[model samples]
Target: MMSKNTQADRNPPADKTAGQTKPRGKGKKYLVGLPITVWLVLIIIVPILIMFATSFYKKVGSNIEPIFNFGNYAKFFTDSIYIPIFFKTLLLALAVSISSIVLGYPLAYLVSRKVKRFRNQLYMLILVPLWVSYLVRIVAWRAILGRGGVLNTLLLDLHLIKEPISLFIYNPFAIFIVLTHISLPFVFISIFTSLEKIPKNLINAAADLGANGPRTLKEIIIPLSMPGVLSGFTMAFVTALGDYIIPQQLGGPNGLMFGNLIVSQFGYAYNWPLGAALGFIMFGIAVLILTLSNKASASEGYLE
Candidate 1:
């Protein structure tokens, strides 16, 4: 019996089907992911590739010439108007992102940490505007900011002014306000999610250790919630950066952004190559921002 057991240990029975078949779960996963992969390639990768290819082409007398050149990229650096408008747009986008964070953080903290009974109601209120049509919201803001609109009417009723003021609409300031309002909800949601993810035990532990509320927040909460802050900031920055519609409607002459230039190149100018190049530049900036944000979040370790 000992000799037989020793032989069995040295040489186990060989399974006939060993290594002949693959795991069903792995094959199933690949099969399931195939459609999504194809869809992504079709919608995203293909368009980007086409755009990249087009960026190398040339435009000649209202027709796109298939000529390959670096003129499109060169023009961005050579043109006097493009660089200034791009810098201005960058400043505006930065301002919008900062404003969203400032306005959203406190509200997010209040709702996520302080509120209990009416939490859902307040959350819904914050999110409700998102369900409305973006164009409708812009139009509504127009009505509110127009010459004889609600703001001026209110001031008139309160006897605070003699007539309606044109101070509110068709300006960069109006564009800023509209962009902030649009971005605030997204920022709030992000911060609130981050706050919610904090383990209650951590707070309790801090309290037990005699750390006060402010100290606890400073020492523990803020550090943990940074990933969400970065995420929200990136979202707001990108949203404001690519916005042409808001600038067109509210920005007036001074509101011309980099997006407007890109739009014109594609639209009336019939310069697809230039437009593609400009779009790729903005796309590169966005990708860089996203990468930096991801790295920052990774450093926070809360994201892990």
Candidate 2:
């Protein structure tokens, strides 16, 4: 009669073979992920590092020579023009993000809460605008907002205004309008995904607990969907901050953003060093906002 321990060792667990006791082979797994890891390092990480390195350098004469100097960053900080523009751009992006969220949340909720049969159709409708060319959308808005344009004609026909509003095209308002339209879809999609994750039983349970519509939405829905809202806002904010095309085309003098200024430095001004520094500053702001958002979300237990 063998002892219990001796018998157990003789017949080990079915899931653990003698070979299984040894370390598993990591070779195949690493090989599978190696290509993607390499691509990301080469394409994304390397470029970011290069940009960071270039930010510390200054341009010399008309040549493409970069002299290691902090003057570019110093100029950005001390120069009244750049600092104010940076703040203004940040403010504008925040406004756009807020506006997009405000407009997107309700639409997303409505679509998400609808019957399954209708949900797909509604989602497609919302996404249809994404298929359209961004440039075409901006140009269409330009035509509608231009003097003697559709809006002006309609208002004139209604005798609402004595003359076409000159403030519509080539203005900050135009830039805001275009940016909002472009960003609305991103917010809507993000919020919709979050709304969809919510179990119907939880909502039913809320109702069973005598929770009213407003109370349930405020206490349950909003908190659960906060992650999506934050993500959408971050995406829209960052994109709007770095937007060059819409502002360049629709914006007149007043509509010019920091992105436009950065582009000018790299292009016409031939000040690559200053441009790199400004780009790095923008990167810093984006990182700070994202980090703060992450911390806040984590504190709220919504970062999972």
TM-score for each candidate, following the candidate numbering: 0.90, 0.87
> Considering summed lDDT, which 10 consecutive residues are worst modelled in model 2?
1-10
lDDT of 2 at 56: 76
Name the top lDDT candidate: 1
Candidate with best TM-score: 1
In candidate 1, position 235 carries an lDDT of: 94
User: Which tens-of-lDDT digit does each residue in 175-263 have in candidate 2?
Assistant: 88889999999999999988887657667767898999998898678877877888899889998999989888999878778998889
User: Which segments of model 2 are wrong by more than 4 Å?
Assistant: 1-25, 115-117, 299-304
lDDT of 1 by residue, 170-225 (tens): 88999999999999999999989988887686778778889999988997788878
Residue range with the least summed lDDT across 10 consecutive positions in model 1: 1-10
